[model samples]
Target chain A: MSAAASSRSGARFWTWLSVLVLAVLCLVWIYPFLWLVSASFKDPLEIFSKGLSLVPNALRWDNYVRAWATAGFSTYMLNTVLVTVGTVLLVIFHTSLTGYVLGRYNFIGRKLVIGVLVATFIIPAGFAIIPIVDLTKTLGLLNNRWGIILALAGSGHAASILLYAGFFSQLPKELEEAAVVDGAGFFTIFGRIMLPLAGPVTATVAVLTFLAAWNSFLIPLVLTFGAPGQRTLAVGMLAFVGTNETDWPGMAAAATLSLVPVIVFFFFVQRFFVEGVAGAIKA
Target chain B: MSLSHSAIRPSIRRRLWADRWIYLFLLPTVVLVASYTIWPMFASIWFSLLDWNGFERAGRFIAFGNYAEIFADRLFWNAFANTVIFVVVAVPIRVGLALLLAVVLNAGLPFSRSFRTAIFLPVVTTAAILGVVMRFVLDPASGPVNEVLLQLHLITQPINFLGRAGLSLYTAIGVWVWKWLGITLIYWMAALQTIPADLYDAARIDGAGRWQRFRYITVPLLTPFTIIITLITVVEATNVFDLMLTLTNGGPFFSSEVIDIFVYRQAFAANIPRLGYASAAALLFGVCVMAVIAAQIVVVARLRRRVAEQ
Candidate 1:
């Protein structure tokens, strides 16, 4: 009984030790973000002077004022919202329709389409940016917000489509058959019955797509090069750093502005994000 | 044969007619994917063959010349080498750390969920923004890292984490691992969830210790997921263009340049944008990535089949 008690105590000791270690690691993990927020509140001199201290000597609201007004973060925020919302809607529309059909039907070219989709997965879309840029320019969509939205959304979200297909495939076909018997057309059934049933999958896709579009950097950078007004928050932060290289506090403020919303959004929808990633891997 | 053909033809036509709506539903996806993904893939090959600047509508076709030039370029090799190093160094560290963390987090410890949220908060933050913030955080002069080091008397002088040529890539890799460790942790946690608790219980009942149970059962069961998580981490490590670009911009004598940055610089950032050469580099790198992916797929399939057999 004494030996058993000792072993249990040892186990408890190890468990608490791990918890302590994890708590410290968690602080270190979030330190950069915390530091950024801290610096955002500090004056430029104090920011460098306060070294490693998370608390500011004084709360300087001018950094935010500068970031919002002078650095054009307000506009960037709006552009990010527009692009993210548009991309999310477009992706849902595309993936749902494609996934619904692929999941339900055995059409003539079904195998061929699936094959093409799978093959494209091997080609990382980052490498194809040059041609995409050229193509977008050719289509007269370059330097346009709609162009950014389209390019962001138009990339074949094969995983998302596959996710929807996996979800839709498992659903009872009797629902569709019954809908058809009740004089429902394909679009009607898809819009009303099928889509409504795919609320979880749609939420997953939306959360994933929203995060991607919101935080995407390179495409928006290149696409909005000449059109500064169209720059997303990610790209604008780079541009902000470029111009305000010496304004560390303001830069931190701008970084905080760009990051806080997305972080908050993640906190709210992280359950879906976690599940979506898990679901995609399983699929 | 003639009668069979006639009978089949009519049914095929009827089936096609019935599936017209399905085809219509597929139209927008087809158009978008073809325009952006499929066409551009072929276009990269076509563009790689031309002696073109990005400004030109058409350039003189110089078949394989760009490929030959890329093969000869020293900078191309530098970027390629750096990318390989980044992938080689980053994937193992990221995957290994994530697995360990996942095991710890999956232990059902108190406040495990909160720890996960804290760790995952960075993953949701913009890499570009983090890149910008890290510069200040790691600044050799009056930065927090240097201040901490100085206070601890760890070094006589502050180390330039991003400025030094030898240290920049590794610093970037470290930061990359920090930002992305959460996703891999999640992958591992998900994988660990698949293991039945009864197996552990059975092992414990059969006089198994914790380490022995882990070694005998958990590790074996986790083999498939490890391969998958490793591959995913490898792919993700390769695609750190945004973070790398924002952080170092492949600076301090191009010490930190990855292949993506190399292509981006040549195609977009250079004084005279070399579209053809950049396309060649991209194509070459794309082929390598594809090969690595293909090899992983084959290995995974074979391993999975073996495990199934066992």
Candidate 2:
């Protein structure tokens, strides 16, 4: 009876201790973002004088408007949308077909091709800069939106394809067979049937690819350096900080603006995002 | 029989034509990949051998000279060391924090879902944007971090976070840990979801404490996810270019110069564009990263098999 009572007490103590520790950690983890939002609304005097404030004396909504327009963010946002959408569409279309071929078909060098694609995942994107730049210049793609799109399109990650392949393999091949028996052409079957069936994985790919392209800085930075007007939001935001003399309020405002689209996308499609990533990890 | 065999051959050819739709469907993707990615990979190999700038007309091939020079450069070595340090330190902390958060969130605490969501918010934010935010937060005098520390009497003087030489890497690592902990947490949470609840129940009934259950049951089962995520984290850390560029710019000294930034500086910022040398450094960086990832994947796979056997 005494032992049972002691054990109960110990469990209570542990539960409380765990809660305290987790609360501290949660705060540490979240403090930066809270600070970011706080800084955005803070008066310049308060920001500079008080360092950081959790709340501001007055809300400065103009900071966001000025940051958006003056930083050439309108153009940057447009470019990012175009590039991200273009890349996601290309990735979904190309990777599905290629992943389908590699997943479902028996062909020459199929394994080797898949292996090579997987290997490129670890090869840092930096290594290809010279050749990419040279090729872009040669093709007159330098400073062009197509340049950014093509550069991102070049590397299809094998893991993502393997993931699609894994899911595809589990899918009953009977559907494709039925389409074939119905005199549906191979492309038609792929386009209508297989593509539609790949919706979940497609969502995953779209979110991951979109975030990747949207966050891409170095590729576009080096590729589009000369064309000042052709900057993506990330690159533009960086240039904004530099040009605007590190305006803390303005910078924070821009940061928030740049994050709005992604955050919105994340909230709406977060279920798919989590499942997609989790599925990939499991495989 | 010979006539029948010839007839079958033509039918096979006709069937292939009928199936030509699939080939046509694959054509655009194949063309795009071949032109953009496959061709550029080959082009990189070719360019790595030449002494050509973006505009140079004719280039002379220098066999392994670039590689030799890359091995000799001091900055190349520093960048390599920084990349290694960043990977070694950041990957473990990120993974560790993530696993801990996953456990906490999965403990069935009230409002845990909201907690998980809040923690994971930073993962969705832009790295470049976070860089700017971190710059403001870590500022010596005017940053909230130092202000809080000063108020709490944690330090006698304001510590120069990103402005100091040795401390910049730590600052970058802190920013990295905060931004990355969210996604890694999600991965862990997902992995945790797959763990059978009965395993924990059995451990509890066997008089195992929370820590013991965590160590024996949770950790062991979670090993596969941990190994995979560790490798992913390491790969991502090694490519730490944009954040470093934005947060510290490899400054207050050259303390934070990873190989990616090193290549950029040499190729673009150098008084004379040593495009050849820069390409060589980049290639060396790539080779080193690939080797590390390959070795890690092998080790993880072997460990996973051993665990399964047990």
Candidate 3:
């Protein structure tokens, strides 16, 4: 073959290869999700009974109905929603405030404060889990939604602050200078000018925080173990598994229900979310 | 006092007073962080000194007893070994696979967006529940994989992927790699994008082969990302408690019990819970994680200085 023909064939081979690789990647990534849905519809007793074609014996809504009722998914979901919302709000408010001030002002101990926040990531706050539990108990926060919310909100300080601060630093000083000239005080400028303009970072932190709070398990497990009624969906599913052992259909349905909300939210904001998280890492 | 010195004192005081709003803005975060994050961190070290079962309000101070116990406990060492093995085996593979995937997807593959989303689905979705769901996939009996294996005559009997003592930790790590691979891929893509394309073009023009270009340019340009990615991996890997809890529960005769599982078991799972000992294990684990991160920070800081100097 001529050199040009060989190069063309090589290019063609790569195109087909990429297509094949991407197709397989998509399949493998999606298979578990598909299996989850299929098993959710299977009969609890009849799951995998037909030799594992990943097909349900029938499309039974019973598992979902049963899981929703038996496992008290409604309460878990409510608890999760409360914790997640509170965490996102608190984190955004606190970190955005901190980031804005740190970004705009040259202040004493600013470097120390930033260093501490960043160091928290390295130190891994988990060493303090026991003390945190005791502190929560002392503060009467254990088994309370507020306990989990406050704890989670206090975490993720470094990344969120950095992301917000990056946004804050990039804003033209003229905008803030105009606001300062308008007799707007700190909170005023922050609320009206800074926070409004920090939409992208806020959205990024909110989505990330929301997903984290929603999916957290061990925190709720440790804090709310004594108060089973207050369990989040993640911890509730653990208990559900303990009780409904081998109830594959019901378990799968429970898992699916827990994941669906986040999955949907992720799909909508994914393009932005990926860019946001990657962007934060760069900062 | 000299005129300039005296004048500067008042200005400093005025600056401090005028910046009260900065303080106020930072007050909630400072107070919340101090109470919830900082306090607990210091408190853990104190807790590690006591001989307590965790339920009681107070306990005797047996200085260094918990740490001594941690050092001596066979299970602790087993867990330490297991965790080290996990980091050694899992982190590189996860980061490596992610780089490969990100490189391919960065080439503008067909359906790149959906592919990124699909792979990243596991990261954002309820991971613990996904672990529980994965149990179904890896179920020895009535699992699709087993059925396929049987159909293909790969094995005579259903293999217990999660139940087997040897395979449990590695299996869990496999799941870990799969779950978090997308985030790493995203990071790699972001880092790769920062490198101008013309460098590659220039290299090609200079008669540099693809391997030479990638070796000299891509690898050098990727150092900061590699450092950051490794840092993220270390942090993420050490925090795999919930997944472990749901996946194997550190089971099959404790073959898979990493330090996180070890800590949980001592604090919560054991019939004779030793909270102090658990704290010691956690402290050690935290120190190790911090040491790794501190090293990475030095590298990252050096990289930053080099970039700045350049």
> Cα lDDT of all candidates, in order?
0.88, 0.78, 0.84
Clash list (residue pairs), candidate 3: none
Q: What is the lDDT of residue B210 in candidate 1?
A: 78
Q: Report how far residue B55 has shifted in candidate 1, in Å.
A: 1.7
Residue pairs in steric clash, candidate 1? none
Q: Which candidate leads the pack in lDDT? A: 1
Distance from true location, Cα of B226 in model 3, Å: 1.7
Model 1 lDDT tens row, B90-207: 9999988988899888889999999998888889889988888898889888778888888999998999999999899999999999999888888888888999999989989999
10 residues in a row with least lDDT, candidate 2 chain B: B1-10
lDDT of model 3 at residue A134? 85
Better of 1 and 3 by lDDT: 1
DockQ of each: 0.63, 0.53, 0.60
Q: Which candidate achieves the best DockQ against the true structure?
A: 1
Chain B TM-score for all candidates, comma-separated: 0.94, 0.90, 0.89
- Given candidate 1, what's the lDDT at residue A49? 64
DockQ of predicted candidate 3: 0.60
- When 1 and 2 are scored with lDDT, the better candidate is 1
Q: Residue pairs in steric clash, candidate 2?
A: none
Judge the docking of candidate 1 as incorrect, acceptable, medium or high: medium
